[model samples]
Target: MKRILFTSTLAAALAAALFMTAHTVTAAPEGAPAPYRHVVLFKFKADAPKEKVAEVVKAFAGLKEKLPAVLSFEHGLNVSPEGINDGFTHVFTATFKDKASLENHYLKEPAHEEFVKLIKPVIEKVLVVDYVANFVDHGAH
Candidate 1:
């Protein structure tokens, strides 16, 4: 009757308030050691052949074996969930220990220089961004 309905409404309101309070109180702590994140976007030239593009992919993929600065790395072609992206031939993500390590990766790594040579002809444009991960949860991926 009225009493049962009143108790149920109060219980639901209390649960929601408790849930919001817990979410507010449990934020991650600050000043965690930062990880350098690198994102690369490649656009192949119009005249670039298919085999040459594939070679670029393969050559870039080989860097993980030779360069230890590449703590985490992956390269993939664009395949949209909605299926409508006609741009950006390739995307690469590489995580480094820090900013200086990333610079070392570019300057000291022979394999990366070699990769540049492989892509010089077929690649028309290259975009790179380096960032630090704040609260990167692997579970989301």
Candidate 2:
């Protein structure tokens, strides 16, 4: 009886330790910076020239080098067959280390302002969304 009790206690202790380890591994570290994402969608004016749109895309892509706060930048034309895009043809995403980095780049950077001015003439509608990225466990169903 004592041996059985000892084995059960050992199993319980092991299970508790594993539970704690799993939780600790998944939890974000204290004071770790959450990733910030800046997303932009643009709908060009019907009369805008293709060359001008391409120039705007090129200018936006160059922001990564001009702005030290940019962690990553990507831009692409919409290709979805679903007609739900509401005339938006281009999308750009800029990732930063944190919200402060994003704010500095967008609000204070001269290069960004110039890029904005370059695109303003051809942009019919624009949508921008910014958010802090959240951790997700894709393995978990």
Candidate 3:
């Protein structure tokens, strides 16, 4: 009788542990902040003049001013010593409240279309990535 009781208790404990693990893996932690991040990297043509590149940069920075959905915007030229940039010189990051805000900025905004038109001639390559930012506070523990 004792052996049967011990087996049952062990099985119950294992099941509970598995259930808790699955639940934690599938659910976001309470109070986690989700921000949509838009990342853009540009590689200008080798023969593009410095003045034209500067103009493109200025036009891109001006996008935040024209778009209400842009929560924050920043950009910089790559200075990494790793030399793995693949000829990409400039990177621009913009944060929006959510995916819908980003869509509005990228799709419906005329300013964005104009910027694209401006850069098309000078751009050699472009890469863009967008995702929901996951912020975790390690100090909360």
Model 1, residue 33: displacement in angstroms?
2.4
**Any residue pairs clashing in model 1, and if so which?**
none
- The pairs that clash in candidate 2 are none
Question: Candidate 3 — number of clashing residue pairs?
Answer: 0
lDDT of 3 by residue, 4-110 (tens): 99999999999987666554432235665477889999999999999999999999999888898888999999999999999999999998888988886665789
TM-score-superior candidate, 1 or 3: 3
What TM value does model 1 have? Answer: 0.68
Question: Candidate 2: how many backbone clashes?
Answer: 0
lDDT of 1 by residue, 1-141 (tens): 899999999999999876665555322346556777899899899999999998888887778878888888898887768755446768999888789988977546878888888899888888888887765343331
lDDT of 2 by residue, 1-141 (tens): 999999999999999876666544333345877778999999999999999999999999998988889889999999999999999999999989888888866658889888888998999999999988776443432
Clashes of 1: 0
Candidate 2's C-alpha runs over 4 A off are 1-32
Better of 1 and 3 by lDDT: 3
Q: Which residue pairs clash within candidate 3?
A: none
